[model samples]
Structure formats: structure tokens, C-alpha cells
Target: MSRRDPYIIRRLNFRKVVVVTLISLLLVILILFAFITESDIPFNLQNRIRVHREHPSLILVDLMPAFVFILLYPMHRIMNRAIGEYEDRVKESQMIVDRNTKFARELSEGEDPEPYPEMIESELGKALRMIQLNIKSGRRKEKEQTWIAEGKDIISKILREYHDPGELSYQILQALNGYIQATQGAFYVFDEVEGRLTNTATYAYNRRKYVTQEFRIGQGLVGQCAYEMDFIHRTEIPDDYVTITSGILGDRKPGSILLVPLITNEALQGVLEFAFINPRIPKLTIQYLLELGEIIARTLLNLKLNLRTRELQEESRQLTEVLRRNEQQLQENAREMQSAQQKLESANIQLENKIVEANHAQSRLHLLLEYASEVISIYDESFRLTWISPSVINILGYTVEEMMGGKDMERIGRNDVVRIRKMLEQLKESPGRIEQLEYSFIRKNGERIFLRTYCRNMLEDSSIGGFVLNTTDITESKQVEKEQRLKSRMQSLSENSLDLIMRLSASGMIHYVNPVVEDYTGIAPGSILNRSCGDVAFQKEFAELMGRILSEMNRRPVKKNLQATLPMLMGEYRAERILSVDAIPEFLDGELETILVVGHDITEAKRIEKEIKVQNRKVQDSITYAERIQSSILPEPAHIRKAFPKSFIYY
Candidate 1:
């Protein structure tokens, strides 16, 4: 139910009070009248009341109960005030409750609820706000701690990941800069010998001030930070300083600068300078940097030490190598003398072994070349055959001695000599260029043999005087290629022919089909391959025609030409086509193996013939009718001759 207005409720409560008070007054008055006039009055009191009826005290005392009604007005006023005050207290309590509820709801919804009433008398509100502030503060502290930990983890990883001093400094500085959201940063490694700092790496430095950046101790902020081994943070930056940028364009002036010294074991390793766009860097990032400075310094120092140690070890190895080389030279000299003596004694023995080994190698080589199908030959710059394998006789029907002194053009086919010369010239232009030429060579028996020569030009080489040729007889391959060409041409013509062609086995199962069958029969060639042409799905007319033709062939080689009208499915209708098909049978050893059927579409031709016949019949009937009319209209041959001596009737 909806709440009633406070004034209305107050009025209703006041009316109830007034009614009860008046009713009580009326009851008292009635009771007073009954007691005063009835038996409750004593005889003496009744006589006194009659005698002093005019006296005020006697009348007042006798009608005191009736007089109680006088207090009703004041009582009404009192009860009205009391109820109004009660309503006010209730309204205040409800408003306070609502306010508290709204405050808690807003807090739960992650709203600031800043303008809400925080009455001083309300202790709960104060306590709740306190709790919220405390939780927010704690969360912020936790987040900062996490952020710092993350930064520290990043730096620690960078330190452990790289060993080179330059890379280590660069990666750590870059990480620190990004973790702090700095606009630009630079890292400088200190040179201990020169007591100076050298800028090693930079992160997004827009303008480099020097080609080789170097600063002596106490020269500038970078050097001072290294010399003093302390961190410096500057918030009031000069206006003339470089503008800050993050992604593409310059945004604004940087508001702060930070220089951190890298110190470990009382030795300066490097210095890091970072610039941030914000006036104040986050304490978490600052703390992270301060804590990581020593780690980075230690890593850099370790890398430098390791590099120095590696250099020292390399130098030592070089010294050792020098000494060992000296010792090896002396030993080599001594061994050379001893080997010279030994070689002098074993010279004849080695010569005999070499002769025997050469003879064995020659036998092996000759045996390989004798049976090898391919011939390996060497030619000079003039294209003269210097060396030819023994297999040349078997391959080209020529003895090795007969081919050795001949020029290449003398044996090559006359028609291909020009092509061979061009190929040879190309081969000679570039040494070590391998090329192949297929040319026919004239054999000793006056037969032309094709050779696929794989030649490599080595014209200027001392070992092989001219080209190294590997020739393989390809005469059989050439004949097979020619036959393949013929077969391919025939296949091309058959497939592209206008007539639909199909080859079937003796039992009428399809063996092969050309693509044109799809246009004539509305059937895909591949789908009908190896399938019977007498399937029920085909048009009944075609099936009957092929069936009759095949049946007749089984009995005897009857009519080979078939004329049939097949209805083609055209969308929602059927189009009848007249196909004149011819059956050709192929026999192997006088037995039918397969039959080839050729279908020629003649739908247009049949339509034109039928139209012409109809037109001719109409013309002949009209001509006979005209002749009859002309004879009927003629008066006589005598009348026409009288009108004109040479009158003639044209029909």
C-alpha cells in the first residue's frame, strides 16, 4: 500500500482522539445527571441542593461530571500536537533509513556518491564511509605492490637473459623506461680506464646530440650521476628542453627527469637517464628502479668481466698457438729430413707400387667404360675428339680409334650441325656450364643414330683439354616420341570432333566415351563410362534403338546406320532430336572385341526437310489450280491468234 500523507494521518489520529475524549465526557455527564437526580443522591444532599440551587458551589459540585467536558478542547489540542510530532519523528527515521540504503547501494555500484548527505549525527554513515576509504586505500596499496613486483620481475629477467654488456644495459634500460612510462631514455656504460661515460643505448631518442657521445666525470648530469653514484630526479624542466613524444607526434614538454647510477662492488658500471611526461613519476616505478639498479649494475659488471676473461683466454690461446706452431715447425723440419732419407730409400719401391696401382686403376676404368651403355669422351677447343670410351663402338657402331681423331661435325647429322655448333659456342662461352643437345650422329654402318649429349665446357682446363661429353643413344626414345605424337594428334581430333563417339565391349557395356556425348545425349561421359547404355534412366527410344542394333549385331553384321528420335529433357518440357548414329566394329583375330558408335545430331536438318516438303506440296497444288483456272478462262486458240499473231499462254 502507498504511504498516506503525514498531515492526513495526523488529522485522522486527532479525530479519533477527539471522538474518544468527547464520548468519555458525555458518559461522565450522563452518569453525573443520573447520580444527582436518582437514588444515589441522599435525602439530606437533595434537600441541600434544592435549598442552594442558586449557589455556584452547590451547582458546580453537583454537576462536576458534566463539567468534565470542558477539558475536551485542550485534550484535543494536546493529542493533535502529540500525533503531529510522532509523524515527524517517523518521517525523519524513514528518510534516514533511505539515505543509508542509497549510500550503501551507490557504494556497492562503484559510484563516488560524493554529494550524498553525511550528517554528523549519523554515526553509521561515518563508519561506512570510513570502511570504504580504508578498503580503497588497501586496494591501491596492493595494486602498487603488484605493479612494483611486475617491474622488478621484468628487470630481473632482462638481467638474467643477456650476457653482453651493451645488450644487457639496453634491454634493462628499455624495460625500465617502459615500466615507468618514460618518454625517452638513454643508457651509458662507464669506461673505467678513461674515467668517462659512453652512451651505449637509447630508447626512442628523437635527436642524437653527438656522433660519438662521451662525457668525462663531472661533465654533465649523466657523468655526475655516475661519479656521485646517486639518483637525481628533476621535476622543474626548462622550456628549451626537447619536447616529449610517445607514438607518432610530439605531445608536450616532458615534466621530469631521472638519472640513476649503476654501482656494484664500489665500481661504476653504467648510468641510466629517463624522462617522463608527467610531473611526478609513480612511487612504485621509482622504487622498482631504485631496487633494480644494483642488479643491473651487477649484471653489467659480470658481463664485462666475462668479456675481459674471454679476451684474456683468447690471447693466451694465441700465445699457445704461436709456441705450438714453432714447435711444430721444428718437428716438421726434422720429419722432413727423416722422410727425405726414407723416401730416397723407398723411391724405387714407390715407383713400382704406383705403376702397379696405375695399371689396376686403368683396368678398372676400362672395364667400367667397356660395359657402360653411355660413352664418356673428351674433346679439345677445336671440337676434335681427344678421348673416347670403348662403348662408342657398341653405341654408335664405330671403333674408339676411328672416332678419336675425328671432329664432332664430321659425324653429326648434316641437318643438325648448325644447331650443334650454336650449342657448342654457347657452352664454350662459359666454362663449367653443362648443356644437353639431342642430335643425330652418322654411324659407321651408314645408319643415323640419335644421341643425347650432356656436355660440360672445360676448354681452358689442363686436365681435360676441351668439353666433357656424356652421350647416350636415344634412337629408340626418338621413335617412341614420334609414335606418341601420332597417337596424341589422333586423340585430339577424336575428342574435339562434332560427333559424339563411344566405344563399347561386345556385350554392350561402355568402355570409352568422348565429351561430345554430353551435348547430344544429355549425359556426362565420365558418369556413363563402364556403364551399360541400355539403362532404364535413358530415353526409351534410344534404348530401343541401341538394343535393336546390338541384338542384330549378335545374330549377324546387319544394318550399321541407326536413325532414331530421342526426346531431350529441356527444363519442364521434352525436345525431340533425330540422331543418325553409325556403328563400327573392331575385331581382334576375326572376333568382335569392341564396337564404336558415332552419333551425329541431325535435328535441324530433319526439321528443314519436313518444312520443305510441306511447302512444295502447297506450291504444286496452287500451280494445278492456276492451270485449271487459266484453261477455263481461255476463249479459244483461234481468238488469241486473231488478237495477236504470236499470242502464247504462259503457265
Candidate 2:
């Protein structure tokens, strides 16, 4: 009933009760008057007495029923009004409950749960509370049935074809649309390198548009969800917020959103956000959406982890194949290189013989010096002051007298003189061009000459003539070439060495390591290097192995071929290595005096060995099968017994 209807009924009942009570009293008075007039005995006296004596019971009888009726009417009206109000409230509450239950069931049923609440405050909160209650009540069986079937199909398709995590995430968003109504959404995960959450997947109504966005840990709505580890309500968000959702949703306006936290174990995974086109959606429905979002988050995390594992596995397989191909190529190239090297060596020897013959034919012959090419002299076996060719003035910037001065040794740097002496000695043994070496000589101007010279020793009948020098200034080239060669040689050694070569200082710091360690440990070079190799590469088991191998070899340089398995790599590895440890009192590059470690990588060899084992098993199986067949070709035991009974089967 409307609020005013009960008051109208009560007023009408009160008026009817008053009218009935008056009519009943009038009837009683008339009856008493008629009775007194009909009797006619002392009429005047009796009428006076009767009028004076009123019966209490009769008066009460006339008014009691009307009084009771009037009193009961108001009481009944009050009771009815209260009950009616209560029933109305129950019905309204039931309607809200039903809506919530429907939303959850629909989600379980793979039906689109509407997105009305943007940020928890409005109708969305009520909607979410209802959904929570329904879920708690376990009334989502029907919904879960449909969701399970559809979700299974979706997950199957993702596993079968969507290898890329981004693509799989997109498919996941699409599948979520089957359950929740949303205009846009995004998936994010933490980037370990950058230490921030980055968008890995997105679902927007307009596929043609794009958004460039990022969030700090606690900067925006999504960030709050991640950092606070709780749901962020839209109504709770302040205006003039730093995080403008406009770029994500087309127009630059604040829309209602419910930022739900996605967390697993001890880590905050990410936040899921739903954008609504219509702002009037009830808060309760939005709550329902948040619960659904949690499910999606869990599934996404698991799929992502699985995808990463698969990627690692695939990468390992590809690397192994590449390594195998490279090894084969190296073997073939080594053969071809050997043949080419022999040919080159023979050609060099023949050229040396011809040059020797030409030098012997011309003694003290003056060949006019060309541009930058000159005749020069160094001491013979006695190491005395030698003759200076006239071309020395042009090449060394010194006159012949100064070049041939008795103090020529004093004029050059100790290093330069030592190198020249070395070169002359080398010439006596072999005739070849002297490689460019850093040296300083005194110019005629008395300035130090930092020159890079290429020289060839003058030889006569396998004996040293004076050394012929061709020098040039190379102060800049020396520095540049030294750095270039250092880097080049380091890179080449890292790539070409079959062994795992690492350099360490006395502090046990790993300065450098080859890439071959990954084959044995499955840990990437980037992850392990620069860290303590003893801690990471040689864990408890491998460390023990190293100690044991060192001790068992009786301190002698040893060779070991071993097999081991690491739990992280999920496989066994066979390694063949030669350990030649020698103490260096003064090692190059200031290395530890007691440190000398040499080991080679033999993962491929180990793999081949395993393959050989498998092949051997197959061969054994084949032989057993063949033997069975051969035995089958022979006579039965009973027949053999019968045939050999007399001779006791001696044959």
C-alpha cells in the first residue's frame, strides 16, 4: 500500500464506530421509555425513577462493541502497514540479489557480464557485493560448467598455435569478452630489466587506434592496484589525477573504472582494468567483473610462465643444432686449411730461395732507393759499428756519418737497439721481413725518432749481410693497432676455443669466461659471468667433483672424461677436459700466482656418447631378436632328447 492509504482507512473506520455507538445508545433509551409507558402503573413516579436509575451493564453493552471495533481498527492498520513496508523491502533486496546471481552465473556460463561500474562507488559496489555473495553461496555451478568447456577450447587453441606470448594474451582478452562487457582492457607484467610494469597485451574496441602508455608502481589507478595489493574503486579516485585514461579510451574524459589487483604467491602480478562506455552501470556489476578478472589473471600468469619455459627449450634446441653444424663445418674447414697452409709454406720457401740467390749475385751493389724503400746496415756476428747505406739519410733523417757513428747504439733507445739486434740475429737464422715493432732512434736534429720499421736482413750464403731496414713513423698506429688487436684476439679466443677458458684475479672474481659453460649448466653467459664462478658455475656437486679430480690425479697434470647432471638444466652432461695446473710466480696480467686452470667443453662429445649407448642397445636388441629366430629354426627339446637318448647327447 502507498504510505497515505492506511491513514485514510483508519479515519473511515473511526467515523463508522462513532456513528454505530450513538445509534445503539439511542435504541436503548427508546426501549426503556416504551416499556415504562406500556406498564402505566404509577407512571409519573416510575418514569422519574427510571430516568434517575441508569443500568451500568446496559450502557456498557450498548458502547462496548463499538469501542472494541474502533480500537482494533487502528491496531490492525498499524500492523498491516509495517508488514507491507517490510515485504516491499524484501522484494527490492531480492531483485538486487537476483541480478548479482545472474551476473556470476552468466560469467560462469560464458555470458557477457555488463560493465557498469567504472570505479567501485556507485551501483557497481552493490553489484559486486551481490556477486561475491553468490559466489560464496556456490551458486555458480552452471556458469562454471559453460566457462570450463569454453575456456578449455580457448586454452587448447592458444597452446596449439599461439606461440608468441603477446598473441596468446590477445586471444585471452578475446576469450574474456565472452564473459564480461568491456570497451577496452590491457594485460601487463613486470619487466625485470627495466623494473617497471609494461603492457604486453591489450584489447580495445578500436583496433586501428593505439596508445603509448606506462605506469609507475604507485602512480595511477592501475599502479595503486599493483602497489597496494588491493582493488581500487573509481569513486575513490580523485579528480585531476595524474593518470589520464583519455589516451587509452579515445576521448579525454574520466570514466568509471574498477582496478582489480592480480597477485600470485608473494609477488604482485599486475592490475586488470575495464573501461565502460556508459557511466550509469551499477557498482554491484562492476564488483562481479573484478572477481571474474581475478580468474583471468591467474590463467594468464600460468600461461605466460609456460610460454617462457617453452621458449627456453626451443632456444636450447636451436643452439645445439647450430653448434653441431658449426662443429662439422670447423672439421671440414680444418682439413681444407691444412692443405692451403702446406701450399703457402712451400711457396714461401721457394720465394726465400730465389731472394737468397739474387742477393748473392750482387755484392756491394747500389740499388737506387725508391720512395720509402732503402738499403740499411746492422752489425755482423761481432756486433761492431756497421756501414750505413746512402739511403739512410732519406729514411732515418740522418747523414751517413751520423748513421755510421761509433755511438750508433747509444743514439737509439735501449728497446730499439735491442729489437734491431734481435732482428739481425733472426736474419742469421732465417731470411724474412721483420714485422713492425715499436722503436725510437735519434734523428739528426737530436730529436727522438719513434718509428715503426719493416725490415729484411741482407743474407749471403746462409750468412747475415747487414740488415736492410724500411722504417716509417707510426706513433698513432701503434696505439690504435694494439687496442684493436687486443679486442680482436680476445673475441677470437672466446669464439674459437673448444675449452671453457676463464681468467680470474687473486680475489676469485671472474673477469672473463667463454660461452661453452652454458652447455653444461643451461645458465646463460650473461646471467653467470662477473659473478663468482665458484659459487654459480661450480655448485656443491660440481665443486666436489673439481676437488676430487684434483686430488685423485696425484698433483700431476691430468685428463678426465666425466658425466654429470644438473637439476636446473634437466639433463645430464658429459665433459672431456684436460687440466694442466701450474703455479706461476709472475703470471702475465698480474694473475694469481697459483692459478692455472685449463678445461675444454665436450658437451657434443658427451651427447654423441649417449647416442652411441642408445645405438648399442638397439644393436643388442637386434642381435637378441636374430638369435631367437635362429633358435626357432632348430628342433624341439623333446625331439632332440629322443634322438640323443642312446649317446647321452654328447654332440
TM-score of each: 0.41, 0.27
After superposition, which runs of candidate 2 have C-alpha atoms over 4 Å from their true positions?
Answer: 1-163, 171-179, 204-208, 236-239, 242-247, 277-287, 325-651
Best by TM-score: 1
- As a whole number from 0 to 100, the lDDT of residue 526 in candidate 2 is 76
Q: Predict model 1's lDDT versus the native.
A: 0.72
User: Where in model 1 is the C-alpha error above 4 Å?
Assistant: 1-67, 105-115, 173-175, 205-211, 236-254, 277-282, 323-651
Clashes found in each candidate (C-alpha, N, C closer than 3 A): 0, 20
Model 1: per-residue lDDT, tens digit, 541-617?
76787787678777675439888887787899978888998887766546675677888999999999999999999
The lDDT of model 2 is 0.57
* TM-score of predicted structure 2: 0.27
